[model samples]
Target: MNKQIALHPDLDDDLLDVMEPDNGGSVSDELSRNLRALWSTFYRNRLLIAAIVGVFMLIGLGVTMLMTPKYRATTSIQIDQQSTNVLGNTDQNSVDPAAAWQDADRFLQTQVDVLQSRAMAITVMQDLNLNANDDFIHQMGGKPADRPAGPLSLADTKREQILNVLSDGLRVDLPRNSRVADISFTSPDPRLAARVANAFAADFMIFNMKRKFGSSTYARNFLESQLSDTRSKLEQSERALLDYARSAQLLDVSGGIASSTDGSTTGTPRSLTTSNLVQINDAYAQAQAARVQAQQHWEQAAATPPMQLQEVLTNPAVMQLAQLKAQAQAAYQQDLQRHKPDYPQMQQAAAHIAELDRQLNSLATSIRGSIKEQYATALKQEQALSGQVNGLKSSTQNEQSRSVEYNILKRAVDTNRTMYDSLLQRYAEVSAQAGVAANNISQVDVADTPDKPVSPKPLINLALAMILGMMAAAGFVLLRDKFDDSVRTPEDVNSKLGLTFLNSTPMLDQEMTPDEALSDPRSALSEAYSALRTSIELSHKGGAPRTLAVTSTRQSEGKSTSAFAIARNFAKIGRSVVLIDGDLRKPSLHRLANVPNGRGFSNLLARMGSIDEAIQPTETPNLSLISAGPLPPNPAELLSGARLPELINELAERFDVVVIDAPPVLGLADTVLIGSTTEATLFVVEANGSHHGHAKTAVRRLTGNGITIIGALLTKYDARKIGYGYGYGYNYTYSYSYGQPDAPSSSRKWPWSKK
Candidate 1:
């Protein structure tokens, strides 16, 4: 019985069962996720993937068309080493027991070895007449007349060659957990293949049959001599058993007990004595059962109260007295209801009731006394039967003691007869087996003529090639995505590096002039820069930064270009923006604008030039450029002077917004020094080229020097490269097309591929 516990009286138990995690559900979820990731990768490189798979398919087709097709024929045979001849003798004098056939693992494996042996190959080679066939000899890597240069004859070497051909073409397959085996042969000729396979099976079965016949031959010779000796010994044992039974007088050879002429009891003294005891035991059990039933009746009557006892209640005298008392009591009750206690009728009725009660008590005592007499008689009978059973038990034991010698004589006769019968049965079986030979191994299925070649399964090979080719291509695509650390999307700058996304500037065609691509209001480059300017203006929680320093972690990150783009976009929006090139070591602004670089910020900062002459106007409405003055011997020293801060303050006053393109922040103090004097700083991160750690470190450097970092700008972002086609609204070429459509090469920093 199970104990049931109630967690909650009204709650359903099945609710608790559903709370456990299901392993099947979790495994299905994991498989689904893997498939989805693979599909995404395949879609992003669909063209590349298709190209790889097509190449593999072509190779598969080539292999099928050019390769040799081989045909296979199979023959099956069942070799049951476990079904050995039962009558095969193992006696020491008959046959050596060590040579006995057994149904063990070694026996079965030995049978398979026989089918795969070189001896079998030699037989097949000779039967098939393969030596005369030049094709077969050449397939063995030899000419028909060629022979190994050794101390062997030519015929011996040719025999080795023929055997090698047979062995090479043979394919033996043993399926798991079975005694049946397949012997298959492959060749250019399908008929030869079939013939060889059938020959192998037939020869093996014929050899196994000869082994069985030999065993029978040995058994017939051995059993003839053994049978005579067994018959004589059986007769001798039978004679000795009969003589012992007659002498002991315990048995008769006629299947009846030996008796005296006077007919006195003589069959078995112990059996006759035990028979009488058995009768006495039956009578004793009967008497004991009767006594137990009587005793139970007596116990029931004695345990009952006299008034409630059946015998007492049903007694004639007691019943009469009880009826009289009940009538008198009723009469007295009637008198009490009608008359006073002193009335004559009331007194007389009370006297009658008292008299009847005395008589009932007397009758109850008589009934109980009679029941006691019955119990006493039953107990006496039980005692007498018990005594009789005990006396009979003693006599049975004494008789058993006297019959010990007779029982020994009888057992000897029985044992001898049983052994003689068993020997007779075994002799009959062995003699019959010697007349016929039986083999356990049989050929179940003959080798069939194959209709087609088994190899070069073109459809299956093509399917597998397609699958494997896709896997290899997909692996390469995923591996490239995994190892490429450059930022390819806006998420790389904001989400991964913990910064704000300002913009993603597009790279235009190299042949196009920078004026139309950067300044056109409708072009993607101009629109992207316009969005970047808006983000810059919104960087401040209060308003846009008045004076902001723009820089990057390393060179060629488009930091200066982004700074100029922002200035030009602001100038288009009717704001005066002054652009300063702070990188004295490698000034690019002047070279880009075809402006004179002789007297610029270097002279102005060195106290030899005026700020007005150093600043130049741009093509845009409200933008001006201050190119790096001639390269200073000490660029860091010139920028570190106190006049640099005052010069920026003056430019801030002259222009509505001053956008200074500082040197790269990493490995240089120029950006840090300029940013410290500016209102805020904007870090430029080139998509897929800027290292995540480099951008993070640049922000930390700027913030460490009390420089306010508005956010980061993502430059040279290509939507197609990062698998954001559907998620993002535009491709790189469509986003930057200036009235014509063509995909442009990526312009981000390709540092690893650079010299």
Candidate 2:
């Protein structure tokens, strides 16, 4: 006994579920597939990839050719503090070596600035005599050979240019916590670079020392002149004071007053004897009398009323009163001259005179009070002066003792002057010794002469050129790719229409009729047809498909040609194949099959002819063609009739394989009608001709009409020009044959007998 197991229809679904988790499976598969797709696309465009790489290589090469080489040299300097005698013994306690090093660093930094300054650049240029050198001028690119030189302008320009060069070529780095600095420079000429660097260091040191020495010397000279003037002035003041004391007999007055007043003097051998005391008293008394008399005279004069004549003349109130009196007197005189005293004018003048007299009395009282106060102050001052004079005469002899101390101070000033002169001489000698130029900087390493130019932007130029070239090529490729809507791969055919790829028919350079294509079946076109046959036969796993219809989305997409090719291929494989022209509006199978273009599907449908009479044999055995027969006024109506389905069913039973060449799916109902009755619909897409959207619309329209869409076949595909290389059909060449030979003749069929 035999046993059978039936699997559920959902088995495939369960297997897929087990193979992949829901979200993870979908995402991972999608990403992997997309990446694979992109990789395939890149590989397919190998020529474009090669071109891009070549462009980049050329760019690199061009850049290398245009680049220049640069050379560098470096020198180092150590800042050291040198002791000098001119620093003075006073500075010995204050000198700090660390602080001195700091100061030296700051000094060197300032010297760096000075070295790059315009003044120093001009000095260096003049010393080198660079102005007349042809080589230097030529290097500078003298636009005007005879340009006039303005010292200030030329100096500024040269300084700026040299500073720029130094900034670009030179690098100075100071080590942390160290007094040493590293200086480096890059240039075209190694020797010149080293020379300039060393010279800069030397000049900086020399300039700093000279500036210090000159400033010190100038300060010393100024101080000397000031000291001399002070000494001279002091001497003159001393002499004048001494002479005054001697003429007044004020010398020894301090001790003389003590001796005369006390009668017993200590620390002095001379005593004020009675006679000398009488003499001193007499002098003092006489001076006192003379001072009293002078004071009394001054007081008496000051007590006298001060001259009030000018006050009376210039005082506003006094002047007003006087002017009124004068005017009244003039009026009185004028009235007396003109008339009697009793006249009206004379009487008015008399009244004015009385008013003027009252004002004058008030003015005189104020002026007298001012003068009295001044006289009282003068009298008080006179008394004080008399007392001061007596005291001064008494102390005159005591002031003479200061003469000894003045002489001592004069001797000390002379001694200090001699010492200062000697120190100044020593300072000069030490400064001269320090003036000798010493190396502030030393070269750590010498740079060998460079044999190559540093820069001409070769690499940069080449890179830019290559980048631009690639950009331009990509732009062209993108532009061309954008406008093209052709199918180029099996994925294009399958994914564009949500259909399985039945086969891909590569194009042939040479032309062959349908009959010849079947006989010589080793061609690429024949091989593609065979692939199509295989894909069609394997579409439905259950059983063989009977009627297959080939159609397109638009006219002239080679649906009829593909149908004829497929029918010939099937016939060659010992199958009875019939080619039917289902495109009633525009029949093409008759032309492709080289038969009469009349009495095809339309004639049979309209009952004008029988199906057998309509069917015509082609040059190839077992392959037949059905022409469109006659033009139908309403192709859609005829195709939709019940007779069409009955006719397709009958043909399926009669022929092993029936290939229908239907009209384009869009803009016509004939393809839909034919598709409804067909066992399978094969969508024929022309490579690089039919839009992807159009192919999708055709599949959608056929499937919507309950037609079983078997798969897709790409027709007229140019494998070589699709971008990468040829398709699989032409990858290798081999030979094969199909179909069974006719039965042997009756005479030969009887036993295996030789004639």
Best by lDDT: 1
TM-score of 2: 0.47
The lowest-lDDT stretch of 10 consecutive residues in candidate 2 is 1-10
User: What lDDT tens digits, residue by residue, belong to model 2 across residues 1-755?
Assistant: 01100111111222233224445456776785555444445555557856875777686776666543445555666654442334434635443333454476677666456555766655645555555444443333333234324654754555445445555565666675665666555665656556555555555555656654433465456656656766675566556545644554444334222243566433321322333554656655665565566566545545654334455557787877787789888778877877887878777778779878877866766675655565556556556655655565555455435445444444444455555576567556656554433333443544444445455456675667677766665665556555545566666665556766666555544445444554565554565576566556656554347888899889877788788888886887789988898888888777666788757888888877788889999987889888888888998888877898889888889999888999998888888888888888888887767764676677778888799888777776554454434223223122112232544434322110112
lDDT to native, each model: 0.70, 0.62
For model 1, the stretches where C-alpha displacement exceeds 4 angstroms are: 1-69, 74-184, 187-192, 200-453, 456-466, 494-499, 553-557, 572-576, 586-599, 609-624, 653-656, 665-668, 688-709, 721-723, 731-755
Which candidate leads the pack in TM-score?
2
Which TM-score value belongs to model 1?
0.46
Q: Per-residue error at 108 for model 1, in Å? A: 19
lDDT of 2 at 195: 57
User: What TM-score, over all chains together, does every model reach?
Assistant: 0.46, 0.47
Model 2 spans with C-alpha error above 4 angstroms: 1-440, 443-453, 467-485, 511-515, 555-557, 572-575, 619-622, 640-642, 704-706, 718-720, 723-755
